[model samples]
Target: MNVAPNNHKTGKEADTASVANYRVDNFTRLVTYSPRFLLMLLILPVLSGLVSVLLPAFGWAPALEQTRFGVQGFMALWQTPGLTQMIGLSVTSGFISTLLAFLMTLMILAAFFNSVWLNRIERLFSPILVIPHAAAAIAVGFLIAPSGMFSRLISPWLSNWELAPQGILPHDAYGISIILGLTLKEMPFLLLMALGVLAQPELGKKLRQQHKVALNLGYYPMTAFFKVVLPNLYPLLRLPLFAILAYASASVEIPLILGPNTPPTLAVAIVQWFNDVDLNLRIKASAGAVLQLVLTAGLLVLWLAGEKLVKVLCNNSITNGRRKYHDKVWQTATIGLTIVILGFVLLALIGLFLWSVAGYWRFPATLPEQFVLLHFQNSFMQMSTPLFNTLTIGFITTLFAITLTLLCLESEQLTTKAISPFTHLIIYLPLIVPSIAFLFGLVWLQQLLNNQTAFLNVAFTHLLFVLPYTFLSLSSSYRRLDPRFANVAASLGATPSKIFFQVKLPQLFAPILIAVALGLAVSFGQYLPTLLAGGGRIATITTEAVTLANGASRRTSAVYAMIQMVLPLIGFALAWILPKYWFKGAKA
Candidate 1:
């Protein structure tokens, strides 16, 4: 070896050694420079939250007196009466709302697939999609309650005489009102998702061409839609469907406002148990959380099965139908449903605005008896701190989520092999799993770290929910980007950073803005993460609305709900306006 190492080596051998060294350095840099590795850095806080929350769920939390594992807490959960009923309510509401939303979405798409009204309907849907679930529930609660504005409007004429407000709709024993409220809130979401799918110019053009061919063969538009187009659209629409299922199943705030109190939905019940001042009851809450998780998983499987069945049936009918029914019944039905949904949305907002300004709005009164601005004034004065806190959290979370997502997209683009499926699994797990389970884990980690920095922890927790959606929205556009420009720029001696800034960034500006707006809306709507991670120290508009809703105080809740609804709409408008003006010099 010593004899060979003397400077007697050939030039060709030296060249081979240099090449091998360069290859090693390149491999090391590639591994170290991955976006997934960068993503891990962003997720450190969430990992801590998950661990913290899990400790308490097990019997490991010292905050509770459970020094050892036992079946005592789970036994208490089983012994609780009406627990079965609560779980049933959660399942029923979740299934029904998702089913109705899907049906309504399909009908609307069948009617307005490429019609003149499509754009108008899409514009209307944007604001509705931004309305927080809690705000929508509270607003619906105010409008449909026994002494609500609807009752007041017809009580004198239809019910006759006016002094007795006996038949009330809010808190109905059957949960019909809850189902209706959830449907109203969820339908717009489904519609938005459908619109996004339909907006794909290539897909739209292909579907339209197919429709024309079918029409020339004497088939009706609805028939063509049900037969030829819907199958293509269903796959694109599944993500939103899963989102609706998850929200409906584990939602706490909406159920608190509209679900039956005697045996509230499982989520509300779990929250009650967790908040029980007794340490032992927390174990029962943990058990209930586990039960909720099981129920959600079961429902998801059922949904997938049902979707498959529907697709098969629809495909069969498309091949078998012999008659041309040009009745446009679907169009009429869709228009009617849209009108009713919009009417309810308008009535809710109007009622909230009126209640916020009323000094006295007693039952059986169509309008407030006396008008005063004091309620609005008071709400604003008290809400300043929470509003600031929410804005700060939302801005930071949105920025962080967008940045992380962009990096991930860049990395995936650079690599040829598919990234880990677990990346998506981890991101979407938060969306489908009960928030309580994840929040519990986060709390345990917080305790272990003994880091009392609540705001940072809370924002990081919100990012867990927000990041998945932001990435999903951005990934499509990012993948669709043409790589030729980057290659050409590189050949021209441009650096990677400069190419991204000068070429890729400009093209993605619109989708990025939309992603940010969507992220802001998600952050604004968070309830459980904010409450649990903030330790009640951070109150967003959602938290304020939920607290007032618990008391069923129409005036204050209405005011807070209005603010919650408005802030997101503003974000959406910016999403639309900023891109249009910046890119095309016109309004979207």
Candidate 2:
């Protein structure tokens, strides 16, 4: 009996031990994998936005007011007379801009599908994508302002009547100018992202094959693109579309320049509240920010729902007899509108260039009365320090982002099972959420950490923005790389580090360079974060450009805008050139 009892106890204990060991092994794997997992979890920078917006919305901000908390702030926000109109402006502008951009992108893609003009058009679109949004807005403002280039060009020739030299175009009570500006800035981004999506090898091959088959069946290219390619492309394009929608809804600077004073967009209103001399208004600003967030989030959800509906419709149509309609009207409209968009972009650039050199070129002058480099000369002298600071920050941020992205890619590759969606989410957190909302909380944190170095903090803040894009650009390339070479090299007794440096790095040098360049561009374009994190001590080209743009001197603003455009162009050029030099003999 004693032996039986002992054996039973031992068996039970062995089973328990086995269970405990399995738990321990699982915990060990989780703990070991937690860093990369945590990286993914960082996607909810939305939480930062909630914290920043909610506290202030509830009147809990110690910096602004001593009000403990109450419904008063929320009520105050609602009761504000122009609040409804402001919300209307934001929603309308955002939706319209995104809608126009989406249609234009679709049209452009449809029109140029597998044509000779496709390459040329894509090449032309590249520079437009690289131009910073704020700079583009400023350029558009210059081009359309009464005293701007358009007025100057047509003033003398038409009816011998001078351009009014005072009224704003499409910038009346409706905020249409804001919509136009945002569309102009966002369309190229959509196109570029579309290009990236279209470049996927499998998708491209499939699309090409489908196009050939459709063409052989006597289908028009546009019809084939719409019927065959759009369904595949839309899914890939969804994220960028969401990004545009969010941006349009929360945009501040563009509306500030072009939106009506009687009732600005929600973003502008929030900015005003934050900047209000009255401390009590900060609560209202917080409330406004919360409202803006809710509105944008709601739109995003709606967009996703619509996408699902469209997918279902498309899939169902495949099973049913869906008549293929070649809408030449749509094709004509798309081609015409795209030409106009391209024209405006070119006009904006030309207008900016002219303004940079214009001495006395005011309204009614077809050409500058006197062309001199004085504005550039003066602006460059004043902006030299800020330019240097921008470059330094951009370089450091890009370097860190590239290194982090490489590590992330390596981690993903080494570990299987999708490496956690959270990692990718975290990388993209900064893009979806509004910067201003989070920067407020970040400011509070900065104040708490009073002893920390400003430069380090600013760089860290920039990393939060740059890392996602760098990782995204590099991830696809990294995953596509063949492991056979590495395996062979390892079999030949090459060290891991040696193989990585000699083989992997050489193979990925071009993409890595492009990723770094993109990171540099993103960092350079940052405005809100730099201002908030630097404690107003560090000046960057973006900060200066915004400040100068707010000033009365169009000439000075033009100079800053040019610099903003030029820096990224230089980075892109370097990104292009370095790989060619470094991997001259290597087969792609």
TM-score of each: 0.88, 0.87
| Residue range 1-588, candidate 1, lDDT tens digits | 455557665899989867766765564355436566645644555455455544455566676655776566667878899888887888898899889989988887777765778788878877887888888888888788777778777877887746746654677656777788888888887887777666667886888788778778887777777777887888777767887888888888788888889988888888787777785777777767767778888999999999788777766577886545554776787789889888878888888788878887666778888998777888899999889988999999999888778767776765655557566566566666667655766665665576688999789888888888788778778877889998998799665555666878788998998899899999999998887778788888899889989885578888898889888888878877888778666343
Compose the digit string of candidate 2's lDDT tens values, residues 484-583.
Answer: 9888987996654455568777789889988887888889888767866786778988878877777558888888889899989998899899878676
Model 1 sits at a Cα RMSD from the real structure of 6.2
Cα lDDT listed for each candidate? 0.78, 0.76
Model 1 lDDT, residue 483, Cα: 90
Please give the lDDT score for candidate 2.
0.76
Local error of candidate 2 at residue 548 (angstroms): 1.8
Badly placed stretches (over 4 Å) of model 1 are 1-67, 311-315, 323-327, 416-426, 482-484, 584-588
